[model samples]
Target: MGLVNKTRITDNLAVIIGNQHIDVIATEDFPFDVQIRFIKTDDAQLDDGSGKKVFTPEYQMAFAAAYKGKSAFFSNTEDIKSFTKQLKEIKELFEFATLNKQTWFDTASFDGVLSQKVGSL
Candidate 1:
């Protein structure tokens, strides 16, 4: 969720994905428009009565790290592959919990992701 600052009047809205706050930087208002579109689709299912809904923070952070670290090159492919595999394991755990009607520890938080991935082992 990157938002380019348009005018001084527009309040920047963003998703706190992890340690970093992603903001869009563009020359014009088009950045805001693009962000809005992402919000519409991304936040669609995250609607509770209070309007706060669950989001996959773990997924977001993982992606953030992957992109920021740029771990897809030959030199970093192993790291990327390892991280992806960890996420896949978490996905499996999430699916199993859902299937069994078992409570899943929150996977939408940074701590939750770390705990499930690192603490479990």
Candidate 2:
């Protein structure tokens, strides 16, 4: 048992850009593809004691972990689990992206990100 046995990714995570909040949803499995868009901004904020709604750190991580048009591929359980660990961390951090009103992605890019799938699991 490794990251594989310890992680499950059946949900989406949140990300923050400026004051805007976005969701990180998996559109594909192989060579992972992640896009950005508004999902829960209305309901995705903490009171912060001053009635100021704010995003969480998990959102930051997810945003940092993904960008628009990003692709992900896992060839082995270890790789999948390794990526899963990041997602799990974000989940723990919404509780824990596109580019438009309907579909948008972050222009920002990362060398290693777990967004969508490339080929097979």
Q: What is the C-alpha lDDT of each candidate?
A: 0.29, 0.36
Query: Which runs in model 2 stand beyond 4 Å of their true positions?
Result: 1-69, 96-121
Q: 4-70 in candidate 2: lDDT tens per residue?
A: 1112334443333322433344424422344333322223446779876565322122223342335
lDDT of 1 by residue, 91-112 (tens): 4433433342212122112232
Question: How well does candidate 2 score on lDDT at residue 75?
Answer: 94
Candidate 1 residue pairs in clash (backbone atoms < 3 Å): 2-24, 3-24, 4-24
